[model samples]
Target: MNPFSYHKPTTINEAINLANLTSRFIAGGTNLVDLMKENVVRPKRLIDISGLPLQAIEATANGGLRIGALVSNSELAWHPLIEQGYPLLSQAILAGASAQLRNMATTGGNLLQRTRCQYFYDTGTPCNKREPGSGCPARTGLNRMHAILGASAACVATHPSDMCVALAALEAVIHVQGPRDERQIAFADFHRLPGDAPERDNHLSDDELVVAIELPPPDFAAHCSYLKVRDRASYAFALVSVAAGLKIKGGIIEDARLALGGVAHKPWREATAEQVLKGHAPSEALFTQAARVLLQGARPLSHNGFKVPLAQRAIVRALSEAAFGNTYAGATP
Candidate 1:
């Protein structure tokens, strides 16, 4: 790792003031530290924000939940409020990294985690995300874990956060503090699609820091599921995953929120599929149709084309389990 100066700031103002073009804020250092060790990200100054007052999980007046940026993944997953009110979020968190890593990964850090694209991690490879104007080797190389939706010619990387997938389904709001002022970014708009500039991951400015995340009122706690499929059962990145939450009334779907991970640069919210299942009865046929609608415009890469069908089946299985409030027979498969 490159030599760097470290600054531990106790206040948000101090953190923001210390941030510069060559500085990066470290909350849990689970992801940033790995990238730094890999030489993917080289920072001259490391601003440690763990000393700031951003570790609370409180209930909002509007029956929502406000989660501080420093809340650890393990804490958030097992918190009473989260487990009782937002089971999907809890499940999604538990579906991610190992227990040791989760204990050190923070909410804000997870949101800012980089993609797990092999080409991007290997500095010797030609990855546009790592070096702009360099060719994308994943475009024609071994790329089974690449994206199947919202990918561009420059990048085919997939976002690796399972928590963000559930957050996208819940429509959480991202609270950011920058040098200018504070602002709220809708979860849908927080992460950006890989357009021309694939190097930039999210919409956060260079100097901005994520303070907290505000979740909307809980509505699908009783009928929500997070299903992650991969090569092995435990501690593996998702090949295709689904975060499904549905509100069913008298055998008909009242409301639905669906999002897909491991498929794009950001969480792929299935708004079209949700619309199709809004007033329909929950059944295998209906769920299959909804999955079909979700994957309508998916443009898979050379080796990742199987993701189209795999993601569709995962969506169907997740919706089925959420609707019936029971695990499906082959949900994991």
Candidate 2:
């Protein structure tokens, strides 16, 4: 790891003031610490925002939930409000890292976690995300974990956050605080696709800090599911995960929200596909059609073509689980 100065700020303003282009905030040190060790990210300064006051899970006045950035993943998953009102979020969080890592990973840190592409981590290799204009080896190398959607010629990396997939389906809003002022970013617009700029992940500025996450009123609490498929059963990143939310009435779908992970640069959500689910009765045929619509424009890589079909089936299964009132499922092959 690079030798860098460390600062512990007790206040949000202090943390914000300490932020700079060459500095990074460390709340849980779950992901950032690993990146530093791998030499994937070498910051000149480490700002310890763990001491800052940003750890709370409260209900908003508008009947939504406001989650402080520093709220631990385990805490958020098991929080009574989250478990009762947004079980999909809880499920997604639990499906992530191991129990110990979850205890250390924070909401903001999870949001800022880097991709798991091997080429991106191995400093000896060439990865566009690691160094722009440096050739993307994953595009033609062993790339079973690479992207199948929203990929570009410059990069084929996928976002590696299960919580983010659920957040996308929940339509959560990201709250950020920069040196200038605070702003709200819609979840759909927060994470960007890998177009020309593969280095940038989300819309967060260099000097901005994610203070909290805001969730709109819960609508699909009663019918929701988070399904993650991976090579191994435990402690593995997703291959093709789906977060499905459905609101059905009189055996007819009234509303639907579906977001995909492990298949794109961001949490992939096609509003048109979700619209296809509305007003239709939940069935195998309907779900299959919706999955087809969701994977319409998917362009798989050399070794990750399986992800396209896997994602489609996962979406159908996730929606069926949600509509049928099932909760969790195994990561079966």
Candidate 3:
């Protein structure tokens, strides 16, 4: 890692004051430290915000849950409230990285985790995300892990967060504090698509610090599933993943939530797809129709074209599992 000045702030205001365009905040250094070592990211200053009082997991007045930004993935996944109410989120968090890495990965840091690929990390190759205007080698190279939707010519890399996918389906709200004022951002508006600006990942400003993630309420606690498909069983980034939740009453779907990961620049969600399932009886054919609506307009890369169909089948499988409350996920050959 490059030489950088470090500052440990005990308060949130002090930590925000220490932040700037060239500075980066470090809580759980699981993702940031690796980027620094690979020379993919170099900050002039490192602001340590781990000591701040942002570690609480409390209940909101609206019967939802308020998860602190500094709460570790392991802690959040295993928390009684989370496991009992938002089991989809707990499953998604537990599906990421490893137990040791999850212990060091915070909720805020997970939201800000960068997209990864061979070209994005190797400084020797040209990657638009690493350096804007540079050509993206993944577009024509080994891109089995590249994006299939919301991908621009400038970048085909996909966000690698399993937690973010569940957050998208849960429709969580992110609260952030900036130099000027504090504001709340909807989960859908937080992560941005490539859209010629591959360098910018999220809507969070450089000086802003994410305070907490507010989940509205638990509705699909009994009917939810998190499915991750990867090269191996454990510690592997997803090739395609699905987070599905449904509220069924009297054999009819009342409400539905579906979000896809490892297939787009951000956690992919389409309201129309969810709408297709609502008010309909849960069935295999209905789930397949919903999957088709979700995967509409998906444009695949050179080597990752299989992701399109794989995501479709995975969506169908996830929705079926959610409706039936089963544990079976995607079946890969």
lDDT of 3 at 28: 90
Per-residue alpha-carbon lDDT of model 2 for 1-333, expressed as tens digits? 889999998888888899888999998898888899999999999999988778998899999999999999999999999999999999999998899999999999998898988998999988888899998998888989989888999999999999999999999999999988999999999998989889999899988999999998899999999999999878889999999999989999999999998988899999999999999999989999999999999888789999888898899899999999767744966
Question: Candidate 3 clashing pairs?
Answer: none
The whole-model lDDT of each prediction reads: 0.91, 0.92, 0.92
Model 2 weakest lDDT span, ten residues long: 324-333
TM-score of each: 0.98, 0.99, 0.98
List where candidate 2 sits over 4 angstroms from the true fold: none
* lDDT score for residue 110 of model 3: 97
Q: Pairs clashing in candidate 2?
A: none
Local error of candidate 1 at residue 312 (angstroms): 1.2
